[model samples]
Target: MKTFLEVKQLNKTFQPDKEVEVTALRNINIAVKQGDFAVLSGPSGSGKTTLLNIIGGLDEATGGEVLLSGQVLTGLSEKELSIIRRDQIGFVFQAYNLIPVLTAKENIEYVMRLQGRNQEECDTRVMEVARKLEIETLLNKLPSQLSGGQQQRVAVARAVAATPKPHSC
Candidate 1:
């Protein structure tokens, strides 16, 4: 399978006020292929979240490189990275990070709107994901109106709805 995401020789460290260096990641490397449902499982503070953050472009590495597809993410400007993240990547966090005021459907549509996807595509993807996840009935319900699982399902839908760019985490 072709590589969809690649991390090579990645490293990240935290320097405390006392000047103690804490290594969060060290020479870490991973290659996830297209359509791979890969999971980074480990104990707490085991660098799973740190690796994900690097993949998601939410955190910068102290060294090394991440190439999503053939593009080097570290070289991209913040604005460009933001657009890439908004348009291509989908994030499913442990928490349901949804807007309490927005209905399930609206929350799903938010990313599409930000990406300027046409109404038809947005509707199609939202409906497809909602149906696939059996959340169609909760489309009009706010985050507060749904159960934890339902909200997380919606979050997953929103993330997967976007067609990823040539390479996205």
Candidate 2:
């Protein structure tokens, strides 16, 4: 399989003060092949979220490069990155960033709606993903109405629905 995502010499640094520089990641390198699952697990404060943020284009790296299907993401403008994120990537944030105003079904359909999908298509995709994630019963519930696990399932459903490839979901 071809390389789906690659991170080369990745680094992230946080500077709270002029004299304090904390390095979150350093010289990290990874390559994920198409259709493969990679898990990152470590102790807390190990930069797992930082690495994921950089890979998802939600945060910037201080050095090195990230490639998604051969497109370099290191230096793109926010607009360009947002376009890629909307069109190609699916991210499930830790906080379950579902809209407070939207019900579970509407939250799953949000990305498809933003992509200009018709109502029929969005509805169908949302139903399919909700069912696949076994969240069909929770579709009408608000984020606040659901339990933590249900909310996470809804978040997964939303990301799966928005993904360009269902296989990846």
Candidate 3:
């Protein structure tokens, strides 16, 4: 049973210079095996998003370790983390953050371009993911032209279009 993701003894605290410290998480431990489906559920402000952000490398954990695949991500430099995020991870935000001026196809192709993929490859991948998501016809429309659900589908297409390589934290 290979671990796909692991969080060990994790803790997160926020301290303002003139205010009391707020502890967001404490001694959290989690292990997710490859191909497993896990869900995090809690009430508002229960640190679900915080834990996700930390796991995604969008925020730093105050203490403990995060292992993705077999990589330790806790102490990596921002540049290194950026590479990891670009090559290994995909994020779909609750708010669909599409570029207003870019067409749906362009939005879906953005990350692939950032990864230096060739134009033909980018185009192919964008169409493939869009078709899979049943948004093939919407690819030429702007974000504002799409419904909320359509926009969310485009965002998901964008996240998966690059077929980012998977690696452990």
Candidate 4:
């Protein structure tokens, strides 16, 4: 299998003041291959979230590099990063972040829309994933109307609906 995502010597530090610095990640390195189910499990404040952010391009690293699909992530502009995030990566936050205005189906379709997928393609893919996860009934319900597990399933479905891209959280 090919490498889907790779991080090398990744580091991140937070500076509240010139004299005070908090290291969020230290010399972290990891890779996920195509079709691989990767898990970043750790206790709270254990850098799992920090590492996820770097992999998803949601946060910057203080040192080292991230490569997704052979493109170096460092020095990319915000727009470029956004394009990469939309085109190549899909993220599901632990928080179950869903749009307040969009229905469950709409939420699933949003990612396809961002990737410039046609309406028919988006609809078919959303339905496919929804059925695979057995969330077809909840597709019309709002996030608030669903249980925690249901919401998490929807998030996963939305992330994986676009098969052309690698999805991460």
lDDT of each: 0.86, 0.91, 0.90, 0.85
- Per-residue alpha-carbon lDDT of model 4 for 1-169, expressed as tens digits? 7887889999999997889999999998888887788777989999988888887889999999999878899778899999888877778887978886788898888878978889999988999899999999989998888888988888888888854743564
Residue 30, candidate 2: alpha-carbon lDDT: 99
Q: Write the per-residue lDDT of candidate 3 for residues 69-115, one digit (tens) a residue.
A: 89999999999989888877778899989999999999999988999
Better of 1 and 2 by lDDT: 2
lDDT of 1 at 151: 88
Q: Which stretches of candidate 2 lie over 4 Å from their true place?
A: 166-169
- Order of candidate numbers by lDDT, starting with the best: 2, 3, 1, 4
Superposition error at 47 for model 1 (Å): 0.9
What RMSD value applies to candidate 2?
1.8
Pairs in steric clash, model 4: none
Score residue 113 of candidate 2 by CA lDDT: 90
- TM-score, one value per model: 0.93, 0.94, 0.92, 0.90
**Colliding pairs, model 3:** 67-169, 68-168, 68-169, 69-168, 71-169
Model 4 reaches what TM-score against the true structure? Answer: 0.90
Q: What is the C-alpha local distance difference test score of candidate 4? A: 0.85
* TM-score of candidate 3 against the unseen true structure: 0.92
Q: Lowest summed-lDDT stretch of 10 residues in model 3?
A: 160-169
